[model samples]
Target: MMLSLALVCDHALIDQAGKLSVLGIFERIWVERFPAVHPRLHLVLRLKGRRTEIGDHPVTIVLHDPSGREILRGDGMVQIGEPPAGVTEVEAAAILVFDVPLETAGAYHFNVTVDSELLASLPVTVSQMPAPHPTPEGN
Candidate 1:
């Protein structure tokens, strides 16, 4: 199997029809506007078939800070159906949502792995929107 997509978004959902719907997909976030550690987010990953994938596979999604420290880690089994021989590929997907402490602003990373194989690394930036300076005294 191979990684098809990895994303960070404000919201994500798998509809009843087996379709994935995502909103506010972004790589940069303004965190200081909200309370510290507020405004949780989601990480969504999609894997595609290469005819070698079958049954359940171990998948891990890890979030790290700019200092190379792990902020959070999530792992689970992804069930993938085997495609017929010499046939088109299929897909598997997973989602992890968590609140990150946004006390500081910097570059972060989302590392995604399938069966212990490094697949993708997605970059995310966290910065604060600068507050406006107080207006000078009016006449």
Candidate 2:
């Protein structure tokens, strides 16, 4: 299996026909303060499977913080359907939702593993948005 696309977004969906729709894709998070909880995040992934690998495979996704600490984990299964008449590979789409809790501003990563093998790692940077300064009335 090979990873074709992996990204962090606001929303994503996979249609019955294997079509993927993604919106509000972003790699950085801006917060007002530390120890913040990002209400919602979406992780979208697309993978291609060879014809010989037509079966159910175990998939795992893990979220890690800047200090390499595991924050959250999600597990699921992916079924590699039989390829079309003359197709040599099959495609699979997965959408995972997360309630990301950030303790400090730094780099975070979402790691994807298929069949116990790491396939993709998506990085997300969390930073504090500077507070606005008040302007003088006369100026």
Candidate 3:
């Protein structure tokens, strides 16, 4: 007679998972009232289902120029929070203040990963500003 063994696991699994959604550049800024100058790129990440604190999760963002050459790389941590009772909405966010240089004008591609899992790859165009016209003397 042959016998087989079965293993079981038990844990409260959080419904749905977290992932990076939209990644792009903010073409304009409120303070500048025009296009952003060396503006920080914004990355939007969405987490579906109930929120739960998972400690700190490692996240990396890589930016590549139009030529496919790497321009910048950054590492950061993402935190998740639990929702209140009777709430089942998913969490979403827009993370900014990345260290990419706005001066490097060109099409950029972003690669984001979570815990070594590739989450998103987005492309954006960054244009160089032309020479500013001098303000005329007097009104």
Best by lDDT: 2
Residue-wise C-alpha lDDT for candidate 1, range 9-104, written one tens digit per residue: 998999886799999888887754633573568888888876666678898888888898888888889998876677777787777888877556
Best by TM-score: 2
lDDT of 2 by residue, 9-80 (tens): 998988887679999999999999989999779999888988999999999999999999999999989998
lDDT string for model 3 (1-139, tens) is 0001111111112235633334332433222223344434455454333444334567787877778887778788765455667775534343534545544555677777766777677666666546678998994
Model 2 spans > 4 angstroms off = none
Better of 1 and 2 by TM-score: 2
C-alpha TM-scores of all predictions: 0.86, 0.94, 0.51
lDDT value, candidate 1, whole model:
0.81
Instruction: Quote the positional error of residue 30 for candidate 1 in Å.
Output: 1.4
Q: What is residue 31's positional error in candidate 2, in angstroms?
A: 0.4
The collision pairs in model 1 are none
Residue 49, candidate 2: how far off, in angstroms? 1.2
Q: Model 3: residues >4 Å from true position, as ranges?
A: 1-37, 49-53, 86-94, 102-106, 128-139
Q: Which 10-residue window in model 1 sums to the lowest lDDT?
A: 31-40
In angstroms, give how far residue 23 of model 1 lies from its true place.
0.7
How far residue 67's Cα lies from its native spot in candidate 2, in Å, is 0.7
Model 3 lDDT vs. the true structure? 0.51
Candidate 1: residue 22 Cα off by (Å): 1.1
